[model samples]
Target: MDYSALRRRMVESQLRTNKITDDAVLDAMGEVPRELFVPRALKSIAYLDEDLQIAPGRYLMEPMVLGRLLHLAEVKASDQAMVIGCGNGYSAAVLARIANSVVAVESDAALAQKAQELLVDLGASNVNLARAPLTAGYPAKAPYDVILFDGAVQQIPDSIVGQLAVGGRLVAVLQADGPGRAILATRTEAGLSQRVVFDCSVPSLPGFAKAPSFVF
Candidate 1:
Protein backbone atom coordinates (compact mmCIF):
# COMPACT_ATOMS: atom_id res chain seq x y z
CA MET A 1 0.00 0.00 0.00
CA ASP A 2 1.18 3.50 -0.83
CA TYR A 3 0.93 5.15 2.58
CA SER A 4 2.35 8.43 1.33
CA ALA A 5 -0.45 8.93 -1.16
CA LEU A 6 -3.04 7.84 1.37
CA ARG A 7 -1.64 10.21 3.97
CA ARG A 8 -1.75 13.05 1.51
CA ARG A 9 -5.34 12.25 0.76
CA MET A 10 -6.12 12.11 4.48
CA VAL A 11 -4.74 15.59 5.01
CA GLU A 12 -6.41 17.00 1.95
CA SER A 13 -9.76 15.31 2.21
CA GLN A 14 -10.29 14.72 5.90
CA LEU A 15 -8.25 17.28 7.81
CA ARG A 16 -8.36 20.28 5.50
CA THR A 17 -11.94 19.74 4.46
CA ASN A 18 -13.00 19.32 8.05
CA LYS A 19 -11.44 22.70 9.10
CA ILE A 20 -8.25 21.55 10.79
CA THR A 21 -6.39 24.51 9.34
CA ASP A 22 -3.46 24.71 11.72
CA ASP A 23 -0.34 24.58 9.57
CA ALA A 24 1.74 22.91 12.29
CA VAL A 25 -0.83 20.17 12.68
CA LEU A 26 -1.21 19.73 8.94
CA ASP A 27 2.55 19.49 8.44
CA ALA A 28 3.12 17.15 11.36
CA MET A 29 0.32 14.82 10.28
CA GLY A 30 1.64 14.87 6.76
CA GLU A 31 5.22 14.18 7.82
CA VAL A 32 4.63 11.44 10.36
CA PRO A 33 4.38 8.02 8.69
CA ARG A 34 1.11 6.69 10.12
CA GLU A 35 1.94 3.16 8.98
CA LEU A 36 4.88 3.07 11.38
CA PHE A 37 2.52 3.57 14.30
CA VAL A 38 0.33 0.53 13.64
CA PRO A 39 1.11 -3.15 13.75
CA ARG A 40 2.42 -4.71 10.53
CA ALA A 41 -0.87 -6.49 9.90
CA LEU A 42 -2.82 -3.19 9.84
CA LYS A 43 -0.24 -0.89 8.23
CA SER A 44 -2.05 -1.12 4.91
CA ILE A 45 -5.00 0.81 6.39
CA ALA A 46 -2.98 3.34 8.34
CA TYR A 47 -4.14 6.47 6.56
CA LEU A 48 -7.75 5.53 5.99
CA ASP A 49 -9.20 8.55 7.93
CA GLU A 50 -10.91 6.28 10.46
CA ASP A 51 -9.92 4.73 13.76
CA LEU A 52 -8.00 1.50 13.31
CA GLN A 53 -8.51 -1.07 16.01
CA ILE A 54 -5.11 -1.65 17.53
CA ALA A 55 -5.65 -4.24 20.26
CA PRO A 56 -8.75 -6.21 21.19
CA GLY A 57 -10.54 -3.28 22.86
CA ARG A 58 -8.36 -0.29 21.95
CA TYR A 59 -8.23 1.93 18.89
CA LEU A 60 -6.32 4.83 17.44
CA MET A 61 -8.35 8.00 17.01
CA GLU A 62 -9.37 9.12 13.56
CA PRO A 63 -7.05 11.61 11.90
CA MET A 64 -9.46 14.52 11.63
CA VAL A 65 -10.55 14.34 15.27
CA LEU A 66 -6.96 14.05 16.46
CA GLY A 67 -5.93 16.94 14.26
CA ARG A 68 -8.76 19.14 15.50
CA LEU A 69 -7.97 18.38 19.13
CA LEU A 70 -4.29 19.13 18.62
CA HIS A 71 -5.12 22.38 16.94
CA LEU A 72 -7.51 23.32 19.74
CA ALA A 73 -4.90 22.52 22.39
CA GLU A 74 -2.66 25.23 20.92
CA VAL A 75 0.56 23.41 21.61
CA LYS A 76 3.50 25.78 21.76
CA ALA A 77 7.08 25.07 20.79
CA SER A 78 8.32 25.84 24.29
CA ASP A 79 5.54 24.18 26.23
CA GLN A 80 5.75 20.87 28.06
CA ALA A 81 2.93 18.47 27.19
CA MET A 82 1.55 15.19 28.51
CA VAL A 83 -0.23 12.65 26.29
CA ILE A 84 -2.44 10.07 27.96
CA GLY A 85 -2.95 6.63 26.39
CA CYS A 86 -0.18 7.10 23.89
CA GLY A 87 -1.31 4.14 21.74
CA ASN A 88 1.74 3.36 19.64
CA GLY A 89 2.92 6.92 20.41
CA TYR A 90 1.77 8.45 17.14
CA SER A 91 -0.08 11.32 18.83
CA ALA A 92 2.89 11.96 21.07
CA ALA A 93 5.16 12.15 18.04
CA VAL A 94 2.85 14.69 16.49
CA LEU A 95 2.80 16.69 19.73
CA ALA A 96 6.61 16.49 19.99
CA ARG A 97 6.87 18.35 16.70
CA ILE A 98 5.09 21.32 18.28
CA ALA A 99 5.80 21.07 22.00
CA ASN A 100 9.24 21.38 23.53
CA SER A 101 8.95 18.18 25.53
CA VAL A 102 6.28 15.49 25.67
CA VAL A 103 5.67 12.78 28.28
CA ALA A 104 3.58 10.03 26.71
CA VAL A 105 1.83 7.65 29.12
CA GLU A 106 0.71 4.19 28.01
CA SER A 107 -1.12 1.62 30.12
CA ASP A 108 -0.17 -1.54 28.28
CA ALA A 109 3.41 -2.64 28.82
CA ALA A 110 3.76 -4.18 25.38
CA LEU A 111 2.40 -1.10 23.65
CA ALA A 112 4.68 1.12 25.71
CA GLN A 113 7.70 -0.86 24.59
CA LYS A 114 6.56 -0.75 20.99
CA ALA A 115 6.01 2.99 21.20
CA GLN A 116 9.48 3.54 22.62
CA GLU A 117 11.03 1.59 19.78
CA LEU A 118 8.93 3.31 17.12
CA LEU A 119 9.64 6.77 18.54
CA VAL A 120 13.37 6.00 18.56
CA ASP A 121 13.21 4.72 14.99
CA LEU A 122 11.24 7.79 13.97
CA GLY A 123 13.82 10.01 15.71
CA ALA A 124 11.26 11.66 17.99
CA SER A 125 13.80 12.68 20.61
CA ASN A 126 11.47 15.15 22.32
CA VAL A 127 9.00 12.43 23.35
CA ASN A 128 9.49 10.21 26.39
CA LEU A 129 7.28 7.11 26.54
CA ALA A 130 6.43 5.66 29.96
CA ARG A 131 4.35 2.70 31.07
CA ALA A 132 1.58 3.66 33.47
CA PRO A 133 -2.10 2.98 34.07
CA LEU A 134 -3.95 5.12 31.54
CA THR A 135 -6.08 6.78 34.22
CA ALA A 136 -3.06 7.93 36.19
CA GLY A 137 -1.49 10.81 34.38
CA TYR A 138 2.29 11.11 34.66
CA PRO A 139 3.05 13.35 37.63
CA ALA A 140 6.84 13.03 37.62
CA LYS A 141 6.80 15.69 34.94
CA ALA A 142 4.18 17.78 36.65
CA PRO A 143 2.98 21.26 35.74
CA TYR A 144 2.73 20.52 32.05
CA ASP A 145 1.55 23.36 29.86
CA VAL A 146 -0.85 21.07 28.04
CA ILE A 147 -2.41 17.66 28.64
CA LEU A 148 -3.86 15.68 25.71
CA PHE A 149 -6.00 12.58 26.13
CA ASP A 150 -5.68 10.62 22.88
CA GLY A 151 -9.13 9.07 23.16
CA ALA A 152 -12.55 9.70 24.68
CA VAL A 153 -13.32 9.59 28.39
CA GLN A 154 -16.57 9.60 30.32
CA GLN A 155 -15.16 12.19 32.69
CA ILE A 156 -11.90 13.96 33.49
CA PRO A 157 -10.33 12.99 36.77
CA ASP A 158 -9.34 15.63 39.26
CA SER A 159 -5.98 13.92 39.66
CA ILE A 160 -5.21 14.57 36.05
CA VAL A 161 -6.37 18.17 36.33
CA GLY A 162 -4.09 18.72 39.30
CA GLN A 163 -1.02 18.02 37.18
CA LEU A 164 -1.58 20.91 34.85
CA ALA A 165 -0.09 24.33 35.48
CA VAL A 166 -2.44 27.20 36.07
CA GLY A 167 -3.73 28.38 32.68
CA GLY A 168 -2.67 25.13 31.01
CA ARG A 169 -5.04 23.47 28.59
CA LEU A 170 -6.48 19.95 28.59
CA VAL A 171 -7.97 18.69 25.35
CA ALA A 172 -9.89 15.45 24.93
CA VAL A 173 -13.05 13.79 23.67
CA LEU A 174 -15.51 13.95 26.60
CA GLN A 175 -18.36 11.47 26.30
CA ALA A 176 -21.76 13.01 26.96
CA ASP A 177 -25.21 11.43 26.79
CA GLY A 178 -26.08 12.34 23.19
CA PRO A 179 -22.65 12.18 21.58
CA GLY A 180 -18.97 12.50 22.37
CA ARG A 181 -17.90 16.11 22.76
CA ALA A 182 -14.43 17.36 21.99
CA ILE A 183 -13.69 19.62 24.94
CA LEU A 184 -10.96 22.01 25.91
CA ALA A 185 -10.64 22.62 29.63
CA THR A 186 -8.29 25.29 30.88
CA ARG A 187 -6.87 25.59 34.33
CA THR A 188 -7.64 28.97 35.83
CA GLU A 189 -6.92 30.91 38.98
CA ALA A 190 -10.40 30.15 40.24
CA GLY A 191 -10.89 26.68 38.84
CA LEU A 192 -10.90 24.67 35.67
CA SER A 193 -13.56 25.55 33.10
CA GLN A 194 -14.38 23.53 30.02
CA ARG A 195 -16.13 24.33 26.78
CA VAL A 196 -17.19 21.89 24.13
CA VAL A 197 -15.17 22.54 20.99
CA PHE A 198 -16.75 20.07 18.64
CA ASP A 199 -18.66 16.80 18.46
CA CYS A 200 -17.03 13.49 17.54
CA SER A 201 -16.83 9.92 18.75
CA VAL A 202 -13.58 8.17 19.63
CA PRO A 203 -12.81 5.01 21.54
CA SER A 204 -12.95 5.38 25.32
CA LEU A 205 -9.80 5.10 27.39
CA PRO A 206 -9.61 2.23 29.82
CA GLY A 207 -10.38 2.98 33.49
CA PHE A 208 -12.32 6.15 32.67
CA ALA A 209 -15.73 4.54 32.71
CA LYS A 210 -18.10 6.31 35.10
CA ALA A 211 -18.91 4.26 38.15
CA PRO A 212 -22.53 3.23 38.72
CA SER A 213 -24.40 4.99 41.47
CA PHE A 214 -26.59 3.39 44.15
CA VAL A 215 -30.33 3.46 43.67
CA PHE A 216 -32.32 5.94 45.72
Candidate 2:
Protein backbone atom coordinates (compact mmCIF):
# COMPACT_ATOMS: atom_id res chain seq x y z
CA MET A 1 0.00 0.00 0.00
CA ASP A 2 1.41 3.30 -1.13
CA TYR A 3 0.45 5.43 1.92
CA SER A 4 2.38 8.45 0.68
CA ALA A 5 0.51 8.52 -2.62
CA LEU A 6 -2.75 7.94 -0.80
CA ARG A 7 -2.03 10.83 1.54
CA ARG A 8 -1.47 13.16 -1.40
CA ARG A 9 -4.75 12.04 -2.92
CA MET A 10 -6.45 12.68 0.43
CA VAL A 11 -5.08 16.19 0.58
CA GLU A 12 -6.20 17.01 -2.96
CA SER A 13 -9.56 15.24 -2.90
CA GLN A 14 -10.85 15.40 0.65
CA LEU A 15 -9.16 18.60 1.76
CA ARG A 16 -8.44 21.09 -1.03
CA THR A 17 -11.73 20.38 -2.77
CA ASN A 18 -13.50 20.97 0.54
CA LYS A 19 -11.83 24.34 1.23
CA ILE A 20 -8.89 23.34 3.44
CA THR A 21 -6.62 25.99 1.87
CA ASP A 22 -4.12 26.64 4.65
CA ASP A 23 -0.81 25.50 3.19
CA ALA A 24 0.78 24.75 6.55
CA VAL A 25 -2.23 22.70 7.58
CA LEU A 26 -2.34 20.92 4.22
CA ASP A 27 1.33 20.09 4.45
CA ALA A 28 1.06 18.83 8.01
CA MET A 29 -1.96 16.72 7.19
CA GLY A 30 -0.23 15.31 4.15
CA GLU A 31 2.92 14.46 6.07
CA VAL A 32 1.24 12.76 9.02
CA PRO A 33 0.72 9.07 8.21
CA ARG A 34 -2.87 8.93 9.46
CA GLU A 35 -2.88 5.17 9.15
CA LEU A 36 -0.35 4.92 11.99
CA PHE A 37 -2.78 6.68 14.28
CA VAL A 38 -5.60 4.20 13.83
CA PRO A 39 -5.94 0.51 14.63
CA ARG A 40 -4.09 -1.85 12.37
CA ALA A 41 -7.25 -3.19 10.78
CA LEU A 42 -8.36 0.29 9.72
CA LYS A 43 -5.06 1.39 8.18
CA SER A 44 -6.24 0.92 4.60
CA ILE A 45 -9.20 3.24 5.23
CA ALA A 46 -7.32 5.91 7.17
CA TYR A 47 -7.42 8.49 4.40
CA LEU A 48 -11.10 8.03 3.62
CA ASP A 49 -13.44 11.02 3.52
CA GLU A 50 -15.34 10.25 6.74
CA ASP A 51 -14.62 10.15 10.46
CA LEU A 52 -13.15 6.85 11.58
CA GLN A 53 -14.23 5.36 14.87
CA ILE A 54 -11.42 5.13 17.41
CA ALA A 55 -13.53 4.03 20.35
CA PRO A 56 -17.12 3.20 21.25
CA GLY A 57 -18.35 6.81 21.27
CA ARG A 58 -15.33 8.68 19.97
CA TYR A 59 -14.04 9.21 16.45
CA LEU A 60 -11.11 10.74 14.66
CA MET A 61 -12.66 13.82 13.06
CA GLU A 62 -12.98 13.74 9.29
CA PRO A 63 -9.95 15.24 7.58
CA MET A 64 -11.80 18.21 6.09
CA VAL A 65 -13.67 18.96 9.29
CA LEU A 66 -10.57 18.85 11.43
CA GLY A 67 -8.61 20.74 8.78
CA ARG A 68 -11.14 23.56 8.51
CA LEU A 69 -11.49 23.86 12.29
CA LEU A 70 -7.73 24.05 12.70
CA HIS A 71 -7.67 26.58 9.86
CA LEU A 72 -10.26 28.68 11.69
CA ALA A 73 -8.30 28.52 14.97
CA GLU A 74 -5.40 30.18 13.17
CA VAL A 75 -2.66 28.47 15.15
CA LYS A 76 0.68 30.24 15.11
CA ALA A 77 4.14 28.78 15.39
CA SER A 78 4.60 30.35 18.82
CA ASP A 79 1.18 29.46 20.17
CA GLN A 80 0.38 27.00 22.94
CA ALA A 81 -2.59 24.67 22.39
CA MET A 82 -4.78 22.28 24.34
CA VAL A 83 -6.75 19.52 22.66
CA ILE A 84 -9.71 17.91 24.42
CA GLY A 85 -10.63 14.32 23.58
CA CYS A 86 -7.26 13.60 22.09
CA GLY A 87 -8.24 10.28 20.61
CA ASN A 88 -5.16 8.49 19.30
CA GLY A 89 -3.42 11.93 19.41
CA TYR A 90 -3.86 12.59 15.67
CA SER A 91 -5.28 16.05 16.33
CA ALA A 92 -2.48 16.84 18.75
CA ALA A 93 0.07 15.65 16.20
CA VAL A 94 -1.29 18.05 13.61
CA LEU A 95 -1.55 20.84 16.19
CA ALA A 96 2.02 20.28 17.37
CA ARG A 97 3.15 21.07 13.85
CA ILE A 98 1.50 24.50 14.05
CA ALA A 99 1.62 25.39 17.74
CA ASN A 100 4.80 25.58 19.73
CA SER A 101 3.44 23.02 22.18
CA VAL A 102 0.23 21.10 22.81
CA VAL A 103 -1.30 19.67 25.99
CA ALA A 104 -3.80 16.97 25.05
CA VAL A 105 -6.33 15.86 27.72
CA GLU A 106 -8.20 12.60 27.52
CA SER A 107 -10.41 10.91 30.13
CA ASP A 108 -10.08 7.37 28.84
CA ALA A 109 -6.94 5.85 30.30
CA ALA A 110 -6.39 3.45 27.44
CA LEU A 111 -6.91 6.10 24.85
CA ALA A 112 -4.59 8.47 26.65
CA GLN A 113 -1.86 5.88 26.86
CA LYS A 114 -2.36 4.89 23.25
CA ALA A 115 -2.24 8.53 22.15
CA GLN A 116 0.92 9.12 24.16
CA GLU A 117 2.63 6.13 22.61
CA LEU A 118 1.62 6.99 19.07
CA LEU A 119 2.59 10.64 19.46
CA VAL A 120 6.06 9.74 20.77
CA ASP A 121 6.55 7.19 18.02
CA LEU A 122 5.62 9.86 15.48
CA GLY A 123 8.17 12.21 17.08
CA ALA A 124 5.61 14.75 18.24
CA SER A 125 7.81 15.83 21.12
CA ASN A 126 5.95 19.02 21.93
CA VAL A 127 2.68 17.34 22.89
CA ASN A 128 2.04 16.55 26.57
CA LEU A 129 -0.56 13.86 27.14
CA ALA A 130 -2.76 14.29 30.21
CA ARG A 131 -5.09 11.56 31.36
CA ALA A 132 -7.79 13.63 32.98
CA PRO A 133 -11.46 14.45 32.68
CA LEU A 134 -12.08 16.11 29.32
CA THR A 135 -14.43 18.72 30.78
CA ALA A 136 -11.77 20.09 33.07
CA GLY A 137 -9.22 21.78 30.87
CA TYR A 138 -5.63 21.31 31.97
CA PRO A 139 -5.44 24.41 34.19
CA ALA A 140 -1.84 23.99 35.29
CA LYS A 141 -0.99 24.94 31.72
CA ALA A 142 -3.81 27.42 31.31
CA PRO A 143 -3.81 30.56 29.22
CA TYR A 144 -3.24 28.70 26.01
CA ASP A 145 -3.27 30.50 22.70
CA VAL A 146 -5.62 27.95 21.20
CA ILE A 147 -7.93 25.25 22.57
CA LEU A 148 -9.67 22.66 20.40
CA PHE A 149 -12.27 20.07 21.25
CA ASP A 150 -11.64 17.18 18.88
CA GLY A 151 -15.23 15.95 19.01
CA ALA A 152 -18.71 17.48 19.08
CA VAL A 153 -20.03 18.71 22.43
CA GLN A 154 -23.37 19.80 23.83
CA GLN A 155 -21.87 22.95 25.29
CA ILE A 156 -18.37 24.13 26.10
CA PRO A 157 -17.95 24.82 29.80
CA ASP A 158 -17.07 28.23 31.19
CA SER A 159 -14.16 26.63 33.01
CA ILE A 160 -12.74 25.49 29.70
CA VAL A 161 -13.44 28.85 28.08
CA GLY A 162 -11.71 30.68 30.93
CA GLN A 163 -8.45 28.90 30.26
CA LEU A 164 -7.95 30.73 26.99
CA ALA A 165 -5.46 33.56 27.05
CA VAL A 166 -6.90 36.94 26.24
CA GLY A 167 -7.00 37.07 22.44
CA GLY A 168 -6.77 33.29 22.28
CA ARG A 169 -9.06 31.25 20.02
CA LEU A 170 -11.09 28.12 20.76
CA VAL A 171 -12.77 25.84 18.25
CA ALA A 172 -15.40 23.15 18.70
CA VAL A 173 -18.46 21.55 17.12
CA LEU A 174 -21.58 22.28 19.14
CA GLN A 175 -24.30 19.66 18.65
CA ALA A 176 -26.91 20.81 21.12
CA ASP A 177 -29.79 21.95 18.93
CA GLY A 178 -30.07 21.07 15.24
CA PRO A 179 -27.26 19.88 13.06
CA GLY A 180 -23.91 20.59 14.63
CA ARG A 181 -22.37 23.99 14.07
CA ALA A 182 -18.61 24.38 14.04
CA ILE A 183 -17.81 27.52 16.05
CA LEU A 184 -14.83 29.72 16.76
CA ALA A 185 -14.63 31.79 19.92
CA THR A 186 -11.95 34.30 20.66
CA ARG A 187 -11.14 35.52 24.12
CA THR A 188 -11.13 39.27 24.56
CA GLU A 189 -10.72 41.77 27.38
CA ALA A 190 -14.47 42.27 27.59
CA GLY A 191 -15.52 38.69 26.98
CA LEU A 192 -15.41 35.85 24.50
CA SER A 193 -16.61 36.57 20.97
CA GLN A 194 -18.06 33.73 19.01
CA ARG A 195 -19.04 33.02 15.42
CA VAL A 196 -20.29 30.00 13.52
CA VAL A 197 -17.66 28.85 11.07
CA PHE A 198 -19.56 25.98 9.46
CA ASP A 199 -22.08 23.19 9.94
CA CYS A 200 -20.79 19.71 10.73
CA SER A 201 -22.00 16.43 12.21
CA VAL A 202 -19.63 14.37 14.32
CA PRO A 203 -19.94 12.03 17.27
CA SER A 204 -20.35 13.81 20.60
CA LEU A 205 -17.74 13.44 23.30
CA PRO A 206 -18.91 11.62 26.38
CA GLY A 207 -19.76 13.77 29.46
CA PHE A 208 -20.56 16.79 27.28
CA ALA A 209 -24.15 15.73 26.67
CA LYS A 210 -26.75 18.33 27.58
CA ALA A 211 -28.41 17.86 30.94
CA PRO A 212 -31.95 16.53 30.57
CA SER A 213 -34.68 19.13 30.90
CA PHE A 214 -37.86 18.29 32.80
CA VAL A 215 -41.21 18.29 30.99
CA PHE A 216 -44.76 18.38 32.29
Candidate 3:
Protein backbone atom coordinates (compact mmCIF):
# COMPACT_ATOMS: atom_id res chain seq x y z
CA MET A 1 0.00 0.00 0.00
CA ASP A 2 1.24 3.48 -0.82
CA TYR A 3 0.91 5.23 2.53
CA SER A 4 2.46 8.37 1.12
CA ALA A 5 -0.24 8.69 -1.49
CA LEU A 6 -3.00 7.99 0.99
CA ARG A 7 -1.63 10.52 3.44
CA ARG A 8 -1.40 13.11 0.71
CA ARG A 9 -5.02 12.50 -0.20
CA MET A 10 -6.06 12.72 3.44
CA VAL A 11 -4.34 16.09 3.76
CA GLU A 12 -5.88 17.38 0.58
CA SER A 13 -9.35 16.04 1.05
CA GLN A 14 -10.01 15.78 4.79
CA LEU A 15 -7.62 18.32 6.26
CA ARG A 16 -7.41 21.03 3.65
CA THR A 17 -11.10 20.92 2.91
CA ASN A 18 -11.82 21.23 6.62
CA LYS A 19 -9.70 24.39 7.04
CA ILE A 20 -6.43 22.93 8.31
CA THR A 21 -4.33 25.68 6.77
CA ASP A 22 -1.11 25.47 8.75
CA ASP A 23 1.71 24.28 6.55
CA ALA A 24 3.62 22.58 9.33
CA VAL A 25 0.53 20.72 10.54
CA LEU A 26 -0.37 19.68 7.01
CA ASP A 27 3.16 18.39 6.52
CA ALA A 28 3.09 16.40 9.75
CA MET A 29 -0.35 14.91 9.09
CA GLY A 30 0.79 13.92 5.65
CA GLU A 31 3.95 12.30 6.99
CA VAL A 32 2.65 10.28 9.90
CA PRO A 33 1.65 6.72 8.89
CA ARG A 34 -1.75 6.55 10.54
CA GLU A 35 -2.10 2.90 9.59
CA LEU A 36 0.65 1.81 11.91
CA PHE A 37 -1.19 3.37 14.83
CA VAL A 38 -4.40 1.48 14.15
CA PRO A 39 -5.24 -2.19 14.38
CA ARG A 40 -3.96 -4.20 11.42
CA ALA A 41 -7.46 -5.31 10.58
CA LEU A 42 -8.50 -1.69 10.15
CA LYS A 43 -5.48 -0.42 8.24
CA SER A 44 -7.52 -0.05 5.08
CA ILE A 45 -9.51 2.76 6.64
CA ALA A 46 -6.67 4.38 8.50
CA TYR A 47 -6.64 7.53 6.43
CA LEU A 48 -10.38 8.04 6.45
CA ASP A 49 -11.84 11.26 7.81
CA GLU A 50 -13.37 9.46 10.79
CA ASP A 51 -11.81 8.28 14.04
CA LEU A 52 -10.38 4.76 14.35
CA GLN A 53 -10.84 2.69 17.44
CA ILE A 54 -7.38 1.62 18.54
CA ALA A 55 -8.37 0.05 21.83
CA PRO A 56 -11.38 -0.58 23.98
CA GLY A 57 -12.86 2.79 24.91
CA ARG A 58 -10.02 4.60 23.14
CA TYR A 59 -10.05 6.23 19.74
CA LEU A 60 -7.76 8.08 17.38
CA MET A 61 -9.35 11.46 16.79
CA GLU A 62 -10.59 12.24 13.30
CA PRO A 63 -7.84 13.62 11.04
CA MET A 64 -9.50 16.97 10.52
CA VAL A 65 -10.31 17.42 14.19
CA LEU A 66 -6.74 16.78 15.24
CA GLY A 67 -5.37 18.90 12.46
CA ARG A 68 -7.60 21.85 13.23
CA LEU A 69 -6.75 21.73 16.93
CA LEU A 70 -3.04 21.61 16.19
CA HIS A 71 -3.35 24.46 13.74
CA LEU A 72 -5.20 26.53 16.31
CA ALA A 73 -2.64 25.75 19.01
CA GLU A 74 0.12 26.92 16.66
CA VAL A 75 2.75 24.57 18.04
CA LYS A 76 6.15 26.12 17.46
CA ALA A 77 9.29 24.19 16.60
CA SER A 78 10.76 25.23 19.96
CA ASP A 79 7.72 24.49 22.08
CA GLN A 80 7.33 21.63 24.52
CA ALA A 81 3.95 19.88 24.36
CA MET A 82 1.89 17.34 26.25
CA VAL A 83 -0.84 15.17 24.73
CA ILE A 84 -3.47 13.66 26.98
CA GLY A 85 -5.12 10.34 25.99
CA CYS A 86 -2.57 9.88 23.25
CA GLY A 87 -4.11 6.57 21.95
CA ASN A 88 -1.27 4.65 20.29
CA GLY A 89 0.71 7.91 20.10
CA TYR A 90 -0.65 8.88 16.70
CA SER A 91 -1.22 12.45 17.88
CA ALA A 92 2.16 12.41 19.60
CA ALA A 93 3.82 11.37 16.35
CA VAL A 94 2.14 14.22 14.51
CA LEU A 95 2.96 16.62 17.36
CA ALA A 96 6.62 15.58 17.52
CA ARG A 97 7.11 17.05 14.07
CA ILE A 98 5.68 20.42 15.14
CA ALA A 99 6.95 20.67 18.73
CA ASN A 100 10.48 20.43 20.04
CA SER A 101 9.50 17.66 22.45
CA VAL A 102 6.27 15.95 23.45
CA VAL A 103 5.23 14.11 26.58
CA ALA A 104 2.37 11.73 25.73
CA VAL A 105 0.23 10.59 28.64
CA GLU A 106 -2.05 7.54 28.40
CA SER A 107 -4.11 5.98 31.14
CA ASP A 108 -4.42 2.46 29.74
CA ALA A 109 -1.34 0.30 30.22
CA ALA A 110 -1.77 -1.77 27.07
CA LEU A 111 -2.42 1.31 25.01
CA ALA A 112 0.58 3.07 26.50
CA GLN A 113 2.80 0.10 25.70
CA LYS A 114 1.57 0.00 22.13
CA ALA A 115 2.10 3.74 21.78
CA GLN A 116 5.64 3.54 23.14
CA GLU A 117 6.60 0.75 20.78
CA LEU A 118 5.01 2.37 17.75
CA LEU A 119 6.60 5.74 18.52
CA VAL A 120 10.00 4.06 18.88
CA ASP A 121 9.52 2.18 15.60
CA LEU A 122 8.61 5.41 13.84
CA GLY A 123 11.67 7.16 15.32
CA ALA A 124 9.58 9.66 17.29
CA SER A 125 12.38 10.04 19.83
CA ASN A 126 11.24 13.42 21.04
CA VAL A 127 8.09 11.93 22.61
CA ASN A 128 7.98 10.48 26.10
CA LEU A 129 5.11 8.02 26.66
CA ALA A 130 3.79 7.90 30.21
CA ARG A 131 1.10 5.59 31.58
CA ALA A 132 -1.00 7.57 34.00
CA PRO A 133 -4.50 8.75 34.74
CA LEU A 134 -5.82 10.89 31.91
CA THR A 135 -7.18 13.69 34.09
CA ALA A 136 -4.05 13.93 36.23
CA GLY A 137 -2.14 15.68 33.40
CA TYR A 138 1.45 14.51 34.02
CA PRO A 139 2.57 17.22 36.41
CA ALA A 140 6.19 16.01 36.47
CA LYS A 141 6.44 17.42 32.95
CA ALA A 142 4.36 20.46 33.79
CA PRO A 143 4.62 23.96 32.38
CA TYR A 144 4.39 22.79 28.80
CA ASP A 145 4.29 25.35 26.02
CA VAL A 146 1.16 23.63 24.68
CA ILE A 147 -1.20 20.93 25.94
CA LEU A 148 -3.72 19.05 23.81
CA PHE A 149 -6.33 16.47 24.54
CA ASP A 150 -6.76 13.97 21.72
CA GLY A 151 -10.41 13.32 22.59
CA ALA A 152 -13.47 15.16 23.84
CA VAL A 153 -14.00 16.00 27.51
CA GLN A 154 -16.97 17.06 29.55
CA GLN A 155 -14.82 19.67 31.21
CA ILE A 156 -11.22 20.83 31.23
CA PRO A 157 -10.01 20.07 34.70
CA ASP A 158 -7.91 22.61 36.58
CA SER A 159 -5.22 19.95 37.05
CA ILE A 160 -4.56 19.99 33.33
CA VAL A 161 -4.94 23.74 32.93
CA GLY A 162 -2.54 24.40 35.80
CA GLN A 163 0.18 22.43 34.08
CA LEU A 164 0.38 24.84 31.18
CA ALA A 165 3.18 27.40 31.05
CA VAL A 166 2.12 30.99 31.13
CA GLY A 167 1.00 31.87 27.60
CA GLY A 168 0.60 28.24 26.70
CA ARG A 169 -2.35 27.13 24.62
CA LEU A 170 -4.53 24.07 25.26
CA VAL A 171 -7.21 22.79 22.94
CA ALA A 172 -9.94 20.15 23.28
CA VAL A 173 -13.43 19.20 22.12
CA LEU A 174 -15.78 19.96 24.98
CA GLN A 175 -18.98 17.89 25.03
CA ALA A 176 -22.19 19.35 26.35
CA ASP A 177 -25.90 19.23 25.52
CA GLY A 178 -26.42 17.55 22.16
CA PRO A 179 -22.93 17.89 20.66
CA GLY A 180 -19.36 18.88 21.35
CA ARG A 181 -17.66 22.21 20.74
CA ALA A 182 -13.97 22.59 20.07
CA ILE A 183 -12.35 25.19 22.32
CA LEU A 184 -8.96 26.70 22.88
CA ALA A 185 -7.82 28.07 26.20
CA THR A 186 -4.72 30.15 26.74
CA ARG A 187 -3.07 30.50 30.09
CA THR A 188 -2.89 34.15 31.02
CA GLU A 189 -1.76 36.26 33.98
CA ALA A 190 -5.33 36.46 35.24
CA GLY A 191 -6.08 32.79 34.48
CA LEU A 192 -6.98 30.54 31.60
CA SER A 193 -9.31 32.17 29.09
CA GLN A 194 -11.23 30.09 26.59
CA ARG A 195 -13.22 30.61 23.41
CA VAL A 196 -15.04 28.15 21.24
CA VAL A 197 -13.23 27.50 18.00
CA PHE A 198 -15.58 25.16 16.16
CA ASP A 199 -18.19 22.46 16.52
CA CYS A 200 -16.73 18.95 16.60
CA SER A 201 -17.89 15.36 16.89
CA VAL A 202 -15.55 13.14 18.91
CA PRO A 203 -15.68 10.67 21.77
CA SER A 204 -14.72 11.65 25.29
CA LEU A 205 -11.36 10.53 26.61
CA PRO A 206 -11.41 7.83 29.28
CA GLY A 207 -11.58 9.94 32.42
CA PHE A 208 -12.88 13.40 31.58
CA ALA A 209 -16.67 12.93 31.72
CA LYS A 210 -18.56 14.97 34.30
CA ALA A 211 -19.86 12.96 37.23
CA PRO A 212 -23.61 12.56 37.57
CA SER A 213 -25.39 14.86 39.97
CA PHE A 214 -27.92 13.84 42.61
CA VAL A 215 -31.63 14.32 41.95
CA PHE A 216 -34.43 15.05 44.36
- In angstroms, how far off is 185's CA in candidate 2? 0.5
Q: Candidate 2: which pairs clash?
A: none
Q: Give the lDDT of residue 61 in candidate 3.
A: 94
User: What is the TM-score of each predicted model, taking all chains together?
Assistant: 0.96, 0.98, 0.98
lDDT of 2 by residue, 15-103 (tens): 89987788889989999989988778999999998889988887999998999999898989999999999988999999988889999
Q: For candidate 1, write residues 59-165 as lDDT tens digits.
A: 88999999999989888888999999998888998898888999999989878888899899989998989788878798889999999998999988888999999
Model 1 C-alpha lDDT versus the unseen true structure? 0.90
The model with the greater TM-score, 1 or 3, is 3
Model with the higher lDDT, candidate 1 or 2: 2
Instruction: Give the Å error, residue 192, model 1.
Output: 0.9
- What are the per-residue Cα lDDT tens digits for candidate 3 across 145-183? 999999999988888888999999999999967789999
